[model samples]
Target: MKGFGLKVTETGAKSYIYQYRIGGRGSPTRRYTIGQHGSPWTPTTARTEAERLARLVGQGFDVVAQRQENERKSVSLAMPAYVEAFITNYLTTQWKDEADGAATLRKHVVPVLKSKSFPSLTRSDITAVIDKIPAGQMATRRKVFAILRKMIRWGIGRGDMPQQDNPLVGFEAPPAPASRDRTLTDGELVLAWNAADDLGYPFGPMVRLLIALGQRREETSAMEWNELDAASGVWTIPAAKSKNGKAHIVPLNDVALAVIDGLAGCADSAKSANSANSARRWPKRGLLFSTTGKTPASGYSKAKARLDKLMVDAEAKRAKETGDSAELIDAWRLHDLRRTMATGLQRLGVRFEVTEAVLNHVGGSKAGVAGVYQRHDWKEEKRDALQAWGRFLEQLAAGEPEQSNVVHLAARG
Candidate 1:
């Protein structure tokens, strides 16, 4: 009828259209496609739709303009898209530990809220996701919640998220886990180190290196051949892999270097075993603790559990020989070795600053303006301290008597 017609293409394809103007002749004309000229959009139905459009236009509705506006604003921002943009734009560029933040989102948040839209996601939805994390992993659960909250706040601030009040603003995160202060005793240390020796290759040598070096677990686990310089006796952790976004140099003493040397033999043995399989060939100079030679060693929990079992067995045997009641050693985590090292350094009369430096810890003695002005890396002091500690570890490993009450360290410049 009026302002309505069926247009036929050169190929004989047909569609119905409605053409109209808002302010009569003075306004530009607009065309709204009704539908293809098929069974649903027959001539009678198309005429009725055109009439309805004319009525709305007469009432100053501007149906075509309104439809265009709605179409422009209809893009749905789903949770996955928002999370991806947040990770790419904010986390990668700004966060010190970008990889971990990105991992938390991809592994925990994205999977649970894949179907939810950003604007429609509620506080309960997020709480449900946090609840899925095990009770024992409170630290991980708390971290995931904090990261998500930070991401949501960031999204809102950037206007990528909905303009309304942030749903996560008032939501509480999982309680922060209690601080850990567990340190292995000297006896426990000896037992654990011997157990690691028996455990062997990859995790075994890796743990021994950790006890001697006191570095982070992941950094030690993902050790590369290039990072170690046998002659220099230093292991350099690159900034990208470090927790604090800075490169860390760990001094290797006689004990630490021996672990590295043993790893070389282990790597050669592993390579020889896998030489028959072309796909599993071990790299000559790649991940030192890797089983596949492509990726770093994993399955840490299982390895740790095995080490614990070995320790218990050794403890029982020692108890039987001594005719003393067997007592279970206190449960300890890998991180406890770091604390034990720090404590041992204190007992050995190493300066607090040197201990902090050995751990590659930022701040403490070198925090605030002191951090900016103090250019000394304490490299020599670190070397001396680790050397002294290494000597101490060797004595323990050999079941030798304690040498001196305090070790003499080089004076810090």
Candidate 2:
């Protein structure tokens, strides 16, 4: 009776009430309307309501404040709603530079969790969705999980969600994947280089350019004629196109220049003759490697598969010629060529700073205060290193053994 009461009006309407002192004795005790005392709110039901409020008071929550907060976020501030708000307002705007990060959330996280109300997103539901993703693509799963966790934290901090307990608190993420550092040996490089040439046109030229320039695959793939300075032998990767968000000046060696020349000729021949043969490699005049100028170069997976077979055939042919069993090279990715070039420079004793400069790495020794102070672009060093490597590649392609010990300055003098 102390915590509960009944009210009756002249019209015979009756209701239940629960009252509580805010600041103890002599302070104003507030009465909360529990329910109308009728079918649903009999004395027994009204008593239960009083008991619930009493427990809440014991737990130190101002039930009135919580109700108001819940009411505020009722429909428009639901879980999915807050998630979208986070993406549009926070992820997209404040973190504008990380477009890929926002895209991943919008693409992967939004669709799966959009309909799920924020309060309804339990650990089990999160785990269930994660479990369905195949183990072969754990890396993607891990990213999605991480993004979702961040979203939950953001909601909690902003008071969009109940300001307690992270839904993903104890759930473990899939192991972070190992970074790929695969590199092709000199033999593999020569074999693959020849194999790419035999493959012909687009994929061939793209592969050669990747190895030739040691640039990223997409950068090589998205090349435009305008980016090339034929006379100076510089293939400029514009800031927008480069991964590091810096314009990269790749000093092209004779072989790289020759490959570019061959590709341009191939594209010209295809266009003049009105053939679709080069259409896949040269979508338009400006594009150097794309199948369609509107998009970056594609068919990488399929093209790589074809290149593998060609390499194996090259191995077989060599075996037949030498009267010895020739073993095909080990498996590798297009990125391995980039690594191989970096490794080759180091093995040849080229300065690591120059190597980093050629790769356009924004971090490591090339970055931070050290990078700021070391304003030297190492342009001349990079050119020398690339030219030396190009000569080695030419020798290998022509069946002449590599002269790795040759000193550039000594030879010049």
Q: RMSD in angstroms, all models?
A: 9.8, 11.1
Clashes of 2: 0
lDDT of 2: 0.73
lDDT of 2 by residue, 21-134 (tens): 766688677777888978899999889889999889777777666777767766556645666677777775444233455656666665666666676678877876677667
- Where does model 2 exceed 4 Å of error? 1-173, 179-181, 266-285, 402-413
lDDT of each: 0.78, 0.73
TM-score of 2: 0.59
- Considering every candidate listed, which one attains the maximal TM-score? 1
The worst-scoring run of ten residues by lDDT in candidate 1 lies at 404-413
TM-score per candidate, chains pooled: 0.69, 0.59
